[model samples]
Target: MVNLDSSIAFLIYITAVSSAAAGVTEACKSVIPFLATDYEARNDCWEDHNHAARLNHYKRFFNLLISVVAAGVIFGVMGLDPALILTGAEKVYVEDSWEVGTWLWGIVAVFGSPFFASLLKIVEGFKQSVNNNLPPNRPRQKVTGPRE
Candidate 1:
């Protein structure tokens, strides 16, 4: 029996499922900064500190929104793209290499979210190094618990 439902699910899996996953991956890649900060940075939003933080927040949101939508559209319409055509004496198989690649990318991105978050710090460090600037000296605190 040809399972039409299974076939449909498979199509969806390789298409929308992976693509949506990629979107989530992109969001994680984009929004890591909000999570990477220490408590001070978290509180800074309420402190009304200055930076293009508001702009950055918007930028991240749009990037995530676009990436997800684009991935969904691309994968759904293409159904595994950049295919490789292989021909034998009596058979031919067109392989969906692009689909596989995107699938792998989505999976890797999900697993690498923490690494992505820390990457923002590394990038900031490099930027600071290039610009010859350092964060202000913070007070030395001997903290034993959350009260500190």
Candidate 2:
């Protein structure tokens, strides 16, 4: 069975990492105008009759690249193995080793961040709806720990 506390902590950590990556990407774009892909830039591109399609393609690629690099750096500095974190596996090997999985985890974190945020919101809404719909006279159920 999944450990509820650890699972929750993991979710929060990943969400924070994703948010940090996004923040870094935005900061980079602000400092480096070449990375900016805002709506205004798109409109400007169209007005100037530039290759908007190529611009869009490069914009997406750079965004993904920046986020992945940010996430990878965060994970690397923390000395956390993305694969083990995702799988809940105990670390049994050398801690200092850097592998390809670390980079892959960066990709996963970038894409999964939004998904995880939406899931948390959905779960929260569901819980609120269930609580609101319960009979007033009925006592709310208290959750202590995971059930056997």
Candidate 3:
């Protein structure tokens, strides 16, 4: 019989690795310049806009991953069987329970949530940096006055 806690722990471990990978990928992507060839230092909304869009894209993905992993942790700690997750009127029990990896996985789950949250904060900070480095937008302002 498979142990519910162990299974959930394994799932949490998997989620942690995946989340970490996604975070690193996002960090790398954030470093690439949108205007690689531009030397004139012109202020273009398109470039800033594109960078913002990409940052937002990774942000959403990372947030979703964290949410899923957090859900896995919740289920695991509650002692709910993964097998019972699908069936409405079914229950599963385990006797032998847990192998060598279960404790390690549980430990990862306990730490992974905060780690992922910190990663999310780093990404947000990178996004803010991009925003700050972007040139300010200046357009023509309307003027109304009586003829002298």
Candidate 4:
């Protein structure tokens, strides 16, 4: 039911929204360690890092922070729920999505990508933990003195 031009515009809008999400996420990744008393990690993750990277990070960080704040306002003013965009897997009740409007889907796509990225990171950690706990396949070789 939505116009083609509006649908395209929504796509672009979400792209900006998602990147703004990424900026907030990145800012938190760097700042949270320091706030949580993880001094060693904080030092390694932020204090010991290259200066150029941190500068670039802050530039996007502040921009996206402001961007998403506005997006949240749009969400409130429009009275649309973005979470509906995430229900692609559900066959039932999804028909209502079309009636709900493209704006809802647009908002979700913009905000959802960051949450998706975070979810991936958490999954990666779980995988690494599982891999680390597996026992060695073979017995360790015995150490021997140097031959004459």
Q: After superposition, how far is residue 140 of candidate 1 from its true place, in Å?
A: 14
C-alpha root-mean-square deviation, each candidate: 19.9, 9.8, 19.5, 15.5
CA lDDT, candidate 1, residue 24 = 61
Counting clashing residue pairs in each candidate, in order, gives 0, 0, 0, 0
Candidate 2 least-lDDT 10 residues: 1-10
Better of 2 and 3 by TM-score: 2
- lDDT by residue (1-148, candidate 1, tens digit) is 2233333333333344445656665666557665333222445474444344665666556555555445545543554431121111122122453445544434433444456446545555555665677665578978687674
**Cα lDDT of model 3 by residue, 1-148, tens digit:** 4343334444444455446544544554466443222233235678876776676666665545454444444434444443343232244332322532333444454456566456555555555666689654568799999999
- How accurate locally is residue 89 in candidate 3, as Cα lDDT from 0 to 100? 22
* Order of quality (lDDT): 2, 4, 3, 1
Those runs of model 4 whose alpha carbons end farther than 4 Å from true positions after fitting are 34-107, 110-148
lDDT of 4 by residue, 1-148 (tens): 3433333333444555566545655566577553223212335555556554555566555554544554554445444343433332222133333343534444465557666456545555555666689653577898999999
Give the Cα error of residue 78 in candidate 2, in Å: 0.6
lDDT of 2: 0.71
C-alpha lDDT score of every prediction, in listed order: 0.46, 0.71, 0.48, 0.49
C-alpha displacement of 43 in model 4, angstroms? 23
Model 3, stretches more than 4 Å misplaced? 1-44, 82-90, 93-148
Q: Which candidate is the best by lDDT?
A: 2
